[model samples]
Target chain A: MTALTSAVTAPGVLGRSRALVRPALKEAVGRMHPWVGEMAAYSFGWCEVGGGPAVASGGKGVRQALAVLGAEAAGAPGRAGVPAAVAVELVHTFSLLHDDIMDGDAARRRRPTVWKAYGTGPAVLAGDGLFALAVETLAGTSAGPAALRLLSASLGDLVRGQADDLLFATRPWAGARRVRPGEYLAMAEHKTGALLGCSAALGAVLGGAPPAVVTGLDRAGRHLGVAFQIVDDVLGIWGDPEVTGKPVHGDLREGKKTYPVLAALDAPSPATAHLVTVLESAGDPAVAAALIDEAGGRTAALAEARRHVAAAEAALAGLPIPAGAADDLRSLLDFLVCRDL
Target chain B: MTALTSAVTAPGVLGRSRALVRPALKEAVGRMHPWVGEMAAYSFGWCEVGGGPAVASGGKGVRQALAVLGAEAAGAPGRAGVPAAVAVELVHTFSLLHDDIMDGDAARRRRPTVWKAYGTGPAVLAGDGLFALAVETLAGTSAGPAALRLLSASLGDLVRGQADDLLFATRPWAGARRVRPGEYLAMAEHKTGALLGCSAALGAVLGGAPPAVVTGLDRAGRHLGVAFQIVDDVLGIWGDPEVTGKPVHGDLREGKKTYPVLAALDAPSPATAHLVTVLESAGDPAVAAALIDEAGGRTAALAEARRHVAAAEAALAGLPIPAGAADDLRSLLDFLVCRDL
Candidate 1:
């Protein structure tokens, strides 16, 4: 790793990415009907619930950062990845807006979710608008076709993941219908990994990278996504409310089929039986949380997350890119996986 | 018009389009999660609300037929246009699925709407799935990038049109906020015409036509869409329930800002004031409908429809296609504008 790569922190890479992507995204949003635009602005954390300016800005730009980094790794300037950055970010926002409505979530990032802030219809349309822009953003560019194929396939995986998650809600906690551990992992990979994979691939492709390099970056991002999702799942179950800005044991209370719960349920420990009973009977969420911990769910989940991260790291090692960019990429992935709630 | 053109009836053109597009459409839907696939099947009229195979096999396939014909007009075989046909049809289905949920509509094509049959969340996913497939269908083909760009822009127009329609619901029947006549027509063009325009353009592009011919065909479709929309507006108000499969005066009852009502409100006749009073006071829908008619709203709307149809015919006359295809195109447009509810 070069001194410049060491000096360039994760936040710096992310800031640079946002600098390039935000303007294009803003222009796209500005072109929408004023009503839908308001909802989209609110979803992006740029406005208050009732439509005034907000200071919070938006997401951490993880996908956008990855896109920029992927470009840099391909020996192109980060600006070369702006279209992919904008597109992936747009898709991420679209998914978040719709998911909030589908999951009946009221709050996110310590603020009201888009559906809760606006009406469900408006939120849905806003999400659709963002999606439309995402596709247009790619198709309007010279490098659009390949990236669009990646995006289209990712959408299928996303819907499949969401569908499986919704279906899991109806399955019994302690019967043959109970979701399996491998099923939970597959869902996580599909729901979260696919977009991350696409973002990396799209960026490299946009940066004029060859197909082999794009495929390698895609694999790295996918593994990293699974690791990141596991961290999120853990936070949902046991993170500090003040830090996560979320209620404690939310996954348990909502009966979410998360990684930790599935891992514990698959454990050979006797505590697994008690965990199922608590979940099935709709008992105290805290009790279920404790039983899951006692059954080694926490350690198992963390271990699984580490394994994926290792896989991501291995994928990154073979990439023929600037060694400095590769180091920065590893550091960024590490930060994502090891972040606090 | 050539003899072959005269012999090719609207139904024949539509039937051939369906025969080519349906199998492709079926295969795409089959790729989704089974739960979402069921809802999509229901939306396409391939299945009942509860999931059994149904007698009703879907929409009129007018967009698909236009796509096929557009390709033929570009001097290519109709089969070359199947990708565009499928893509446009997919986008149409996507709009309908989301629109049903947004509009709170209960029935379409004499069956329960997707959201009404399944839950809103499931229907939303199903719409998104169709949208995903639409993009993929384009991107997977050689003619993808340009067609995808057209589709993306059309989505923006479609959303803008819908947003305007939704916003109009909050406007007063008799005040400064009353929807303007020009605004309503623009909204109608956006909501009803954009995808139609895209369908024609996409087909010609897929058939290897140059950009100028694509633009001309797009304009023709746009005019036809406005004419088709006006006819639909009239049917909503006055068409027999048995034929239309809709409640009588549904637009008035639902306070829809349709072309006829906007025309009536804009008229110089004294009866316009009475119509406004009836609408604002929430008086009987039938009374409002009759007053709107008495003010010549129906005549005005039909006249507007005829003008658009004429515009469409004029645009088609300049096309560089085989004369037979042009004649067939005009005949199809005529059938769409002239059909009974």
Candidate 2:
């Protein structure tokens, strides 16, 4: 482990970042057209459907925290990162809206997805609106042009990653070409890491950090994002539905080729073969999980997640970030990847 | 009619604009990731499915022409407008992609729509990618910040317009909440006019035009867009399928609440009442068309189109546009509003 990872995780960092970002996000989204603003509010859990009062519960705001921590690491005020934080959250929400439609996901956060609550058309428009608003918000900042470019390029990577995910899902595993583990990692990086990296880089830029420091923060973000996704893949099968706000073995039941399942498939053992057979047959989730566990899939996934976390710390080690801010980021990384859900 | 309108429409002006904008659009889209780039190419009718070679016939490039004309009006070379032109066309294409999915349109330009051919998921992503690419392309220009702001605000208006349209379509029309003619026009202004206005404004800004000139050009573009939509409503019910690349009475059959139909419904005549009844019952397209025509809906729509065109001309008249550029714009406006399809 790097020196950064060895430091104690900072308490209250996540909550403090949320405190800074939430109001800013609300203001930016409020500036949208009424109808879209309402939809966005609902999507963000700011208000109940049909413009009722705020409900308050929302996502973990990990990206927003990262943005704040990144800015602080460069010795800028936490408020200096608000625009980047809001922008990143908006992008994340936009992706969720579209992804729910594309994946036919019915629930998110234990509630009906936007596409389910609102029609597909409105949901699509709302997502588009959020994306435009994100760019608009960033463009209004002092770092407008640079931030816009970074976010736009990150969006491109996101779409490509989603396209690859869909393509891989549809392609047969027995085909002449199957998605390799490396390709999956690349897709994860593009899909999840790109935006996180952008978020950090944007904060660093907003803080007026030097190029090398910005690049280092970006790399750190990418590593954390990869680790986050790998941990998510593990949770998809083993996580408590009450905690995760998702069904147990959700990914396995859907035959999702997530890291653990893919790793199990790559393993050369009878249990691995059995796991593949169970998956192909749409067997029970418990049986599939047991088979995967017997094949050491869970262990391998956990190891991979740890490896990424270590890499994330290593990326931060050489950076010129202040010690306190680095500890905050390390805390964030730990909270993200080491969560039970 | 202006002296320019009295003359024959410039024989190759549209063709010339297409030639300039198409290559620039292709190059910009080429800069996108291969997946989205291929999808964009296919959507633009530049290629067939599965990454085939270029096939070519695409949109009318009206917005591209307007961009170039706006630039020339500001005394810049037509090529100075290429980036703005490409950006507008990308925005237009992005709208088409989403609109097709929302409207369940199976074909466009006599070929399968992107959503129909490529599935809803990829189509949505492709639209998103195009939007990002549009802003990205604009951001690369010297007028990047201003252009980005214009396009982003225009996008917000576009989403609001789409939302209003969907809301109007779903709402009952017999009560105090019936969609007013003014509201429909406003929606059209938001949905169609905003981007066209941005396109012109962008061109003017790119050409280093004065602020007043930019605003005037934007107003002219908005009027032109309104006129174009009104003309399209007239043709939707009356134009030959062979000419419009749509089924005869296409809008009527689909029960689209276009300008003409709304005008007919608002008319104080038995024919108007009968048209409403027919529409409510999903009556035959021929019957609905006959009722609308008898109620003078066609005439009213034509008048509205002409009024908007005149307003557009008046907006142009006050600007310091060179006489030749003014004439070109007037001729283009006439072509747009007077065309059969």
Candidate 3:
């Protein structure tokens, strides 16, 4: 298949996907939660009746793209990936909803976060509903046993990753030290990579790809997930506020022990000392940003993120897909991990 | 099958269930959020491994038992309900973990609560793990489509009910003020009944019982769940400390809007005024208990529970099964909704 135009590739896939996903997502929402239209519209950055743009934001739908791409790569030709993509997206939505609540995050997609808008109770309930809807939808898939296992295992990782994140958050002992690159990669893999892996895995499985091909796609997804996370970490700390729709140095302000801080900590500098003290102090964002910059933390963090992205790109070398498909996938990875948004 | 004598029955079904449930529950604890175990252990009445003779301290294990019994009633026969039972219990455990944290309740099953034993973060993660594990286990169950659907929908209700409960707590508006008995029943049915329904439903589906039988069993489970919650409400107010292991009028102390309180609220009087005032007020448990008695709320709650028990009994009528099995089920309901401990 010819590679779609660069500008249109993602939007094109999402546009096609929205057609399939919209109705299923709507029905699933109804089945799973009350005030479904309102919550979903608010979540998707659409008005209650899809009236207009609810927010100036949304994801590139990369994971759903993986599900779609995996199915194509596995030779299920036309849109067999639709159902799997919807299910994967639902799980992703669920994770985002709950994670925001747990972290007390107040914004998403340049708008009030689910918990912030609807309160924690509704946010949690909506998340749970999405989770159930994901599983229920997966069970309905024609891909059958393999699809079931893939989705279930992915759900497990989602929880386990969440557990690790929460554990890392509260356990001073666990997170006190700066994160090593390897450890950071592993955390990223668990926290984000696993679901992407499931996305590709489901696509491959449902599309009837050979076992080795399935394995290759899974690895590709893991690498992609890690890369995505590292990029996210970079954006979290230093991305332009206009593009990212978040304050610069947000992570430092939150005292988040992301890759750069962890890397910097290992160098045994006074900055590390100042940083720790700053994190302990709970100052305003300006103070936190000043401290982080003074420490030269942002550049170091970006370098670490770059290293992970390089590694992720290297993992894609083994896939035997057609050249255009491979390039599209590569471009997608770069777009995700390097974009301003 | 011949009816087992009560002497024989005590150690037969109940005894074996204890044996089955104990080890599984242990394994579950071992595997959950590692941070949450200390708190969870305390809530489960363990100071350490092999801690004090495992208190008959846990609930009737009604949720789990319903799964087990449902399996039999539905015909997957011996022990097929175990997985579903385990899953339902995990859901139950999840609720309790969060409920304690939410209510700031300091004790459970006669021991320090999860949040009390460990801390809020660990407690929340622990509860979250249990919720994850519930679906995780069901993924491994032998019951095909039906069981999966049953379990997923059950979990959906459990979360939604929790949301409702939380919403009610935060906003006690007129709807909340005049909370009808039916609404209370609906709440309990959703919060409590749904899980139990899944339990029984799993059994019937796995057991290969006909669809009608499964439907009948589901209705019975709903009645049983309502009966259980009402009974629990009664125990919360006036049951013996030795038997209940919780503080007398503990629900009232927490100002939980249970069925009895709602019933009295509907027909306002000096008693209802006092009861409502105490619930709306913030003070000591002793003061609250005194107000409950002054309002004649305790007796009314108990009477209401008995009414529910009778309704529960009526729902079990004409279930297609051997007389002895039906009798055992009836006795089991009594053991569930009527038992002191």
Which candidate tops DockQ?
1
lDDT of 2 by residue, A78-157 (tens): 88988999999999999999989888888877678888888887888999999988888888787857777888888888
What is the i-RMS of every prediction? 1.1, 1.5, 3.0
Superposition error at A46 for model 3 (Å): 3.9
Docking class of 2: medium
**Residue A71 displacement (Å), model 2:** 2.7
Q: For candidate 2, give the lDDT of residue B224.
A: 82
Q: Candidate 2, TM-score vs. the true structure?
A: 0.92
DockQ of each: 0.75, 0.63, 0.31
| lDDT against the true structure, each candidate | 0.85, 0.82, 0.67
Over 4 Å off, model 1: A1-8, A339-341, B1-8, B339-341
Best by TM-score: 1
Worst 10 residues of 2 chain B by lDDT: B2-11
Q: What TM-score, computed on C-alpha atoms, does each candidate reach?
A: 0.96, 0.92, 0.80
Candidate 2 residue pairs in backbone clash = none
